[model samples]
Target chain A: MKGTGCISLASCKEGQTGKVIAVLGDKHVRERLEVLGIRKGTVLMKKVQQMGQGPIIAAVGNLEIAVGFDLARNVIIRVEV
Target chain B: MRVLLTGNPNVGKSAIFSKLTGIDVTTSNYPGTTVEFFSGTMNWKGKTIEIVDVPGIYQLNPEAAAEKVAAQMIATGDVLLNVVDATNLERNLNLTLQLMKIGKPIVMALNMWDETKHKGIQIDVDKLSAILGIKVIPTSGRSGEGISCLADAVLNAKQAPETNWMDKDRWKTIGFIVDKVQNLSGRKHTTIEYIQDLFVNPVLGPVLSCGVLYAAFTGIMRLGKLIEKTVLSAFEKYYSHVILTISKFLGGSGFLHEILIGETGAGGVDFEAAMGVLTTGVYVSFGIVLPYVFLFYLVFGFLEDLGFLPRVAVIFDRLLKKAGLHGFSIIPMFLACGCNVPGILAVRNLETRRERFITAVLTGITIPCMAQTALVMRMVGENDGIFVLLVICTLLTVWCILGLFLKSTVKGITPSLLMEVPPYRLPGINAQLKKIRMRMTCFFKDAMPYVLGGIAFINVLRITGIIKLMGKLAEPLITGVFGLPQDAVLALIIGIIRKDTAVAMLAPLNLNSTQTFVAVIILILYFPCTATFTVLLRELGAVDTIKAVLLMLVTTISAGGLLNLALSTVYTPRGLLITEILIIILVIEILEPVKRAATEKKQ
Candidate 1:
């Protein structure tokens, strides 16, 4: 498990496909993320967005979620290809 | 039964559809393409069920994009899941009642049930069901809460006799049923209560607002540079070297090479031409815009979700009303910062034609879009800090001044500030992202084709002798008036197609810092974007479109040309600094009187 500093989702490069190590959120948010399948060990590919690493387009299965720098900072991901 | 899922924008309609069909239709590309009802098959109780995700909308009367699609969906649904934003019960119910008036086998899915709980909102589900004469399934699509119960409710509604939400004029009915069954205990904004006074405490609000904006710009720039270096460097190593060779091998000052590569002959390296779109267009789209756009969306969404936008709405309300519009018009203007199409289209919800016209034109002209903002922020912000601040300050000043101009300078009755300030909430993560994606996707999709095509077409225009002719024809004003080199005509021509490409065109020119500033100003005030052009044509028709163009043309030439001339003589380091300070003081002083007059008028 590793924590990366805040980077836009679009800029998450290859070989750094991260395991979503944690999701820090409030109540509705906790539910929202869980519903969207953004859970612990959820394998996520950083889908390069219109903005690289500024807003990482994180994908789990068919769900694509854009995370800005702030939210991404809190999301510890196990960086792996 | 063919089931239709529908609701107001950002409601759980798509969320529910995704849950039911397990299908994700990228809801991003709305501005570029019209997505009718999306269909996917679901297996329910060992039987194949066809599910349709209708576009979200407020009314069957069909105002917005989703509304039209929903109206179309309702026209042909066997069963309808009328998803309601349960927290905003009254607002959601208004639309639900409208759908019920249509006499469909409707199932009211109360989405966002989790939020309703926190708000101390109580909707007796059974009572609401009985009152509406429809099965009401209170659902939280977020946590997978009550989803099965919702599915069961849909199944039950299919077997049972159908019912309506209301039989007569629904507000009258809703006013009654809601009066009895719905209890909205106004929760002390536990929520944002502590921050409310802090965020908008007159003096405190301004300080906080300025501090936040300053931080946002600084944060985006600092982070944006790192992302750009990382993303663009990787792209260059992969693509630039390859495309450069291929572009060289083609070896022609001819149409094909020019169109394929740029006229500057810096055709990125091999495969890079094919791939440099990622390097340049895609990189610009994501990298440059990403940091700031994300920041913009995050900050704006937080402000929005925290209910600050409404307070801003309250502040801007009287100003908006003066221009024959309401404070709601500010949304489109805000959205205009992303891009102008939706910003323009969003004007449709305005109460009157005059409001839409003024808002559309003003948004088109005044709002520096993502592409332009990206370019300005990237080039100017990175290279010079104080100048960048100056530009941003100028932008804000212009927005306020133009807003006041639209409100007062134009002779029209002040519009109303009739709006619903949604309660402040810690904006949901997924919801905020969903909103951001919805916006940025619309921007990217609309711009991508035009950007690629504009680059290609600019290349084609150069070799085809079209640019030479344009340069010559526009020489008098382009050079003589605008005080720019004839090459600037090319930038202006390209600006019509896409603004960033026009600025990108400036890279080849050996212009000094002052010239570039003038160029950017010209780009901002010069003309409406292609998307904005179409919307203007649609909303104002031909005559106003022409007037709009003329207004832009006169302003661009005058503003840009005058600034250029003035700066050339007066822009010695000491003089320019002094002038800026004086202008700042003058502006603040001008604003004080205006505020006083406005307050006096109010009294």
Candidate 2:
């Protein structure tokens, strides 16, 4: 629950993919996101930073989403890496 | 045939157009979003295909610029080429799915195919097409990969049956379909994440954020000097030679020659009689503004490509929110470093009216663009040490005070910040050079036309004695109200006309140190340039725009009065310039540790 010791996004040494449980943004924003289909169970995967502090990029399947140090903090996950 | 192309920001939509049509469109990582649109035409498959590059939006229901324009395009477009970021498929597919539901003949072009291989991403193209029920073409516009195939797909789709994907509510529904078809790897927590968690943890994030702010601001000025040195000399050489040849042919000292191109005194190039406007007009825009502006965008593009701006948002988000704004508002502030127009237009992304109001005011007033900054630096750098420090400190102080004051006065109820922090990529030299070339071309095109017209207008006015009449009319306010001379009044008029032109105007005034400082202050606040004016008018409306103008006038006058009083009365030789810099940095630094300790204590 706290830290993925060595798991990777798909099957690497450090990342894992997961679904969005809730896009718990503020009301207007949350509503807007819901309309965009960026809602509950929308799959995402954090590509653990290979360097620096940790995962610099995240993934949702093949698509790469670069995660700044700040955003990766808000994303919560149930690991299967 | 109408073909609408849309993609996420930083994708090659505009690049594709230029390759297709031979039109050079200015592209940028939208200071606000990662997306925007460009439209051009290409002759393909025996028909003139009018391709509209719809601003790349994440969805049709967009609150941001690209998304809004994108949705509007969808409602009207006949053929949709939804350009998705191949490197970021699932997030991109979200957009692709939305486009499909727009009911147009939708095809997805996965731009940046080379990045996928470099990043080691694998895409199941056949599976994706089957799931989405639309054509998906993988492309590498950079390497000329799959472009012909893409053209063929477009040609084929235009000829094929009409698909009514128009149920937009389906964007909300398609995530489930994406889930069934897309086998994503699962998420897992790791020690590395835990390590990252330390930096991103709310308590520490703000501290790290502050450090980044200090670094970026410091870095901009410090690196700005190095970059200016590298490029300025070449610009000087090239322009001097070109103008020298032109002047020689026109006979530099001739009555016709002197007005079109001024004698090279200090900085003024005398063009003959009074039409001298035409010569200097070309010089100021193409010679001065062109090179400097192009350089700024090149640096800006590099910074953007490195993904530093969003992190900047994260850093500033706390202070900005105290003003009842969000981190995303930083996008406009950052862009304001370029121009206020796009900066103001960027405010539309803010969720509420109040946020937009505050953003507009801050952008117009506090954020000085490359033009302003260049002139300010030129003056300050040339001046005596102490006054330069005061000017710099005064600017920063005013920026902070305005943010605080507006936050207090403006009524806003929204305070949320959700932004993606793209990984810091080293801006490729090839890409950087291309971006710079494109930007310079755009800037030269945009500014050259305006300058030539303005100079020509002024020339016509000068011959008719209208500039004198205008200057005479404005003299009372210039001398009495703003404490500047009658001649400097003309500079203010030209300042509002074009910043570079105004800078050129100042070279002939022969003002002493204090007068130079006063002139700069006047130039900085007179009025938004025409480009900014149009954007502000478009974004904020006539009444609000008027109010903003009034605010600028009052603030500039009051500020000028105070500065004049201070300089004339109590000015000392050795002021607190260095002390100010140190104290500001120290204050900025100290806040971080104190906040961290407090957060830790609470935890």
Candidate 3:
């Protein structure tokens, strides 16, 4: 888990579970992600990634959030095997 | 004393607010439903208290307009009733922790408590209260469980002891507290979860959404038509005769009789065609508009509570993106299909002024209310379904073209969709009925006076011969450009008050199919009714409203002219198809340069 490279949450396949490694972007974006429980160490599961780089839907702590494609790309996570 | 109801999105803060205040602010399963604050009064210990239901936000620092409103509202309240979703205590407590730092007296309502147990989640409420240094009352906003205790907690709420935690470290503090007081036993994934998964499954999701929407649309329309024929016609038949008998007893030849019962033709009162306040006004509102509005709201309320809106938003995100709006903007447009006042008001949920303006303008111009649609169906649809289809297609074309035009011209970036897709739950019928009842009450109280008064005002103008003079003045444009009769000007003027009534007025004008189609399109495009106009003025402010109105005027006249020309020459299904294709091509050509420039600017 430590040696494997981290991928952006946007790249995670549907049904993949991951631990958020870091939320990239400015204070505002990070704060938004944090408030929704998507900070470092938070475990999230990818639910749906709409085609054509649409919003990325994921579940974090029983609540599903639809993050825009641009924002989802900044959320780095380590997918569990 | 002002008590602010604050919580993370979709935590039933609105439900709790309604329970405490007896005011019905709309409550929905999805997030961002309450985009503006609603205030109502409640009696606490024999003292009247003012309570405000603030828009839900994930944090104190604002990233959007609704969140900014919530943050501003937080500073003005004497006490904060912090609602937390009991099923998601760990995540919700982050906001609760932030509220504690505001130093306001806070009482926590553990809402959705019933769901927590169902999900195999357990919370030590006493321990949680001790840790946060506040009273924590477990309450179910749906079933009203623990509401009295919540009210007691609110009345006796005390400010927390000063904490050493910094704002930046609040999450850590929340984590620490949640570890001590919350426990989640592993539970099996249920059927609802599977259904939720299917709803967002890119391919099946969109298909299911279309199916659901089609079903809801057909159900609402069919039931509405049924009620209109059965209930509404029956009510109008008896009510008009009763009013007619009374008017006749009172010697029905004077101005008062004209205002009340209207000109009694040979057959009956002629409620629809008559321009009288009592006849057309009552008939339009109660007989025509009320049935459709009721049926639409019932179906819409059920859809809203069932939590399908966000999924619809998800499916329509890319499509709405072309309109320079996020998917959530569709909510307001959907509401507009029922009526435009609440639709215009719902634009507050959008993130930017540009988006709100675009959505409002598009909704006002293109989406006909159920009443207007019903009227068009009865009149034009009876002759040919193709004409009805043409009306819809024309409006859809206008929606797309105008939306793209506004997007390219309006100066703001359309925010991307960042929303919670709540789990689909079966709607509670009792709550749904209550919501419909509340909305109906609001319609009667807020919209009815304007409908009736506007009719009376128009009637007065007609009696004084001013309407005729105005009609003469509007003759060249109304008859010459739109190809409708001069009397249609009166309908156009009355349209500003009520669009359905305006269309109904077309009945007496002896209009052919083309004239009726053109007139209906113009009525839909010209302007929203006076009630909607007032609400839009308040929502978008004066300058934007003026811009929107000007846009509507330009679009309405041009659309009427174009339709008349098309129908008069080369009038065929292929001709309409060609016109639609030309519009799409024109929009694309216009959009390409804008898209290129935007990308260049980004680079």
- Candidate maximizing TM-score: 3
| The 10-residue segment with the lowest total lDDT in model 2 chain B | B266-275
lDDT of 2 at A62: 42
Second chain TM-score, each model: 0.78, 0.77, 0.93
Q: What is candidate 2's local distance difference test score?
A: 0.61
Cα lDDT tens digits, model 1, B520-553, are 7788777876867987798678987886687677
| Cα lDDT listed for each candidate | 0.62, 0.61, 0.84
Clashes of each: 26, 44, 0
For candidate 2, what is the TM-score?
Answer: 0.75
Instruction: Give lDDT: candidate 3, residue B162.
Output: 81
Q: DockQ of all candidates, in order? A: 0.01, 0.14, 0.71
lDDT of 2 by residue, B1-603 (tens): 788777665566775665666666644443234234566778877878888766656655666554676677777777888877676665666666655545678777878777665555566777777766777788865556787787778877732233445554454445555555444444554554454344443456556656655565556555665655554455455655666677789876755555566556545334211235545665455445655566567667776666666655655655564455766788787777775655777787776777887788767765666756766666656767666667667555555555556666766566445444544445557667776776666566666666666666565565677878888898777776666777776667766666656756776677776777767866776577777778788887898789778877876777667666666667542444454465455434454467679999999
Residue B590: error of model 3 in Å?
Answer: 12
Where does the lowest 10-residue lDDT sum fall in candidate 1 chain B?
Answer: B26-35
Of all native A–B interface contacts, model 1 reproduces a fraction of 0.00
> Which of the CAPRI classes, incorrect, acceptable, medium or high, describes model 3?
medium
TM-score of each: 0.71, 0.75, 0.93
TM-score for chain A in each prediction? 0.61, 0.51, 0.92
